[model samples]
Target: MGDELTEETGHEARAPAEGEADRRPGRRALLVGGAAAALGTVLLAREELSHLWWRLPGVDHAREDGAVDYRGAQWIAASSANLRRADRPDDYRIDRVVVHVTQGSYRSAVNVFQDSSHRAAAHYVVRRDGHVAQMIRELDVAFHAGNRQYNERSVGIEHEGFVEKASSFTDAMYASSARLTAAICARYGMPVDRTHVIGHAEVPGADHTDPGRHWDWDRYMKLVRRARTALA
Candidate 1:
């Protein structure tokens, strides 16, 4: 009887151990599955947040003529001063469209514009990915050109292209800049000719050379013409 009782106790212990071993894989699988699910949720949330932050306003809908309103596009404001005039001229009379290339990243460009110590700014900064950032209002004079006289009459647009020969301006950036230039010209009654659209290098005694040699001026001009035609 003693031997039989001992054998029964051993069987009971072995049964529980076998059962626990069988459940181990399922428990581990559940833990791994839960971790995977959590990671996916986190990634999805991050994507949604990024979309919300970068999405531009008034560019999604189509008009009656099937044309979208690009002029109403808003950008992240980075200006430190309210240099804009409360009462602007009824007829927008911009004389020149000045093109530049930020020698840094889009974030860095905005930071420099915002930083008082830098004492540098531009009206607009166009990203390589085709994102537009407004540092100053159109009516306000941005401290872009060292010459205050030129700054007063010019609309400065800084493109995202590195000074290195390896870095090239993307198609999206060219397209976006053309569209932006067209909108500005239309609003301000500025001509789309080369005389009106000048590069930073062309500015007299400008002392800055940007939108470097890698930028395709011919392709950019073609897009600009297309945009002008569209506006017309």
Candidate 2:
């Protein structure tokens, strides 16, 4: 009668096999591990997706054209035409600073940066009055250097006004730009020397002479050195 009742009760109440008891925890552990892995994968996917969304228009990041301005300078994004979006210090190293002259007023230079067809942009722009604007982020690449290799590894700073006009490179402009250059050198572990800090005219590929004759390297370097020491 008891056997009949056991049979009627079915296998739900049956004793587990000798080794099955030991494997119960293992099976549970496997399920937990799988769930954790799945969650991790989902989280990673979410992160990638979020970053991808940041590239699209309307997101609270760099504009559809450029990245947020470098180190909190006024955010004047050059848009998509001027800079290349990149993962910096990861894909490229910033080891040099390239100086440039806009050859135009600050307003005109800004307009050029915003224009898509111009295809030119610098990381920062120092106005004649010493006010600065950052059109691109330090983590990304700007298209100011004529040399691709240099462009990839250097930060370009464009000064408003023509190189021919020594007055355009005013004391305030020099002091401001020098401070920025020094800050960049300090951050990138670059030596504040003529070798690492050069004018656009010095780029290897060579047919431009911007920040030219009047761009006083001697005084500029002195200010840069002072700024570097102040930072320390």
Candidate 3:
């Protein structure tokens, strides 16, 4: 009845003359043209488009601000300035879990993450008493790892207490942290081993040593494997 306008050309598409085989584009044709236009736009704005995809509805819908990846972890929003927004396993493939030590109390770790000037934070913090607080979402990138590539590709978990204190690595802390790490590994389909589950010190170009010497890797790995098996 009325002339259809093609968005890209902004020109009126002529309607087929009466009984002249009505060659105006159908729904399928319109859809194809729209898709092509969108593709062209994406090509022109590729870099900025990368960060905007997750915001689109039904794509990778944004999770609630304080949503916790781990079921039992308490939700505590980290300063938005402290972390980088990203679409993980989409923009960045997360294959490792970087372990860190707060060198202070759990509450202090949370406070630090809430400070915009700190410019660093892990995804989760495990307290000495086995409590877990999730400050950053797994979908985003936290700045805990000093190295940029490592920070982009791994989830960071901080344990409460100083690196030099073996007593800080309590049984409760180990058990809870193992379960959390196992869950993360399972989520990302990562192997439950030292290669994938590594200390902050092991990160390439890391300046800080954490979950340090007294962390007892042998026992922790055993616990993680056991926890992973149980999850299966």
Candidate 4:
């Protein structure tokens, strides 16, 4: 009769405090299991983690031009070899725009920026077709200007083609580059005049004259002012 009662109840007729069994893991075991699982996940996702790095507060990886403007231009981040990180508006004040002429095709310029050996790049590159590519973020300094002071306090824009080729400075290039410059000026509180917006030739100790005589300052400034108004 007692055996029949035990079979029906699934337990012996005894005090649970004295006879109960504890099969569950303790707190230390649970913590160890969780840590092991987390480690496994990290190891499994190493390939994905390797492709990403810490970017500045304003960096937009989804952007093709790497800027928030979302104009037709896209962003392609330059390698670390061509740029260095800096806290903009806090550590450095970008008060000027330095224009340059790439002498080579836009593709060639991008290739050079990607190469560690070249050790040079700009914040933005305006192509002959008026398409823009932002290689470096505005918050960081690009190795564009020959002078350290100019590089530290200015945003460098490279126009596709050589200083000697007046034909490369197309109407579309002027308008697009002007719009970009206006946007930069607006963001940085810089004036769109020639004093604040200058050529690579204007830099102190600069040996090269790019965006030289062929670059129409009056037309570019007019376009820049108009673009800034439109953007506002």
Candidate 5:
């Protein structure tokens, strides 16, 4: 009877061992499923990150014209670039192009405009490499000139330079500014003449002085003329 009891006990233990072996495949399947889910999540995150860089909020599509959708641009704000519709009742007609120099690095100029304490702004900032950054919209006035009247009618473009001793603007910068100004003129139906395009120094006021003695007036005019012809 004791021998019989010992055999029964061994059989009971073997039954449980078989049951545990049967669970191994299920455990491996669960681990593989978890790894696949993790991989899928990583792929989804990568796609979302790419979209974040290129797409802007509120701008669903790009315009046919070269002009970027200001509403979607990351740098623009509702209070700064997005002037209320009531503020701009009339269509913006860009009559004059005012040239200025940042008197510092391109990065510095962007920082100043972003800083509220700096109390300075411009419609466009042209870099030494001829890269252009449009800070404010054409319709909204920038606080470039102390005089509001001039600011309202003129589009200010700040170049990277200190013009007192600098004899010439960078070739790239000059080319970019000329091209941009020509585009603005074409869009607004403005003439590309000296009267319409003036240096910051030429602005009527006692305080305004920029794109100073160092800037080459004749060379700049030639570039502007060339750009106008190309645009036309």
Candidate 6:
């Protein structure tokens, strides 16, 4: 049976005991497979292994707790269980910014992120009044996106309010979030565009329709571009 590796289920293939039958290849064997087919299999699924590196002890340098990436944002650490510590950009290059809308208020979103049981949190939360809160550090990976690859390669920003309520998207929120997204783009040398800056609904295999129909893409993108120019 092929070994299954997922964000939820991190099971690896175990080797047979010394004298046991070689029914399935172990983890070590898979890494250094001899046959061409085995090598091909390894190449196809190598990304699955990258996700586990952060779990290793001392893989990345220690970071100060509660350090905010955005200068003026408040620092509120997310649950350790809700985020994975990694040396990002060094390990997984960040290329996308995923926009999300919390189905509730700013405080509610922060509370849920602090709860380990939530199992999900974003790197930052932008409130309606343009207040920003940094939960997970930019150097780590948050379990915000349902898709594992997207989670690793993107920074998720959760905006306060429901997707259906257009009024929830305030002018203050847009300006502040645009600056934040622009900073992210500038930091990673990513272009401020639709493909790089996407909504949660755009994620592949995502069931959630967040930053939904009410989200004004043209307004948001224009604001992002203006903010990016200011930074440049």
- TM for every model, in the order presented, reads 0.63, 0.70, 0.77, 0.70, 0.63, 0.79
Best by TM-score: 6
Model 6 alpha-carbon drift over 4 Å, by segment: 1-37, 40-59
Clashes of each: 0, 2, 0, 5, 0, 0
| Whole-model lDDT per candidate | 0.70, 0.84, 0.91, 0.83, 0.69, 0.91
Candidate order by decreasing lDDT = 6, 3, 2, 4, 1, 5
Query: How many steric clashes does model 4 contain?
Result: 5
* Candidate 5: stretches off by over 4 Å: 1-92
Global CA lDDT computed for model 5: 0.69
For model 5 the TM-score comes to: 0.63
lDDT of 1 by residue, 1-232 (tens): 2333334456322234544554434777999999999999999898545534323565322223222224444455544552333111222246888999888788888777777677668778888888887666675566787676577677889887676643548878889999998888777788778898888888888887766677777787789889988889
Q: 1-232 in candidate 5: lDDT tens per residue?
A: 2333334455333233544655434777999999999999999898545544434565333333335422222343223432212112133345888999888888888888877666668878888888787776675667786666677677888898787657337888887788888887776777888899888788777376788877877878788789889877
Which residue runs of candidate 1 sit more than 4 Å off their true CA positions? Answer: 1-72, 81-92
- In Å, residue 180's CA in model 2 sits off its true spot by 0.4
What ranges in model 4 sit over 4 Å off?
1-70
Cα lDDT tens digits for candidate 2, 1-232: 2332344546445456777774345777989999999999999898656545545556433434434434546878786778887655556788999999999999998899999999889988999888989888887788999887888899999999897888889989999999999999998899999999999989998688998988899999999999999998
User: Candidate 1 — which pairs collide?
Assistant: none
**Over the stretch 1-232, how does candidate 6's per-residue lDDT look in tens digits?**
7875644558775666899997656787776666767778887678667755765787766787667888899999899899887788877899999999999999999999999999999999999999999998888889998998899899999999998899999999999999999999999999999999999999999999999999999999999999999999
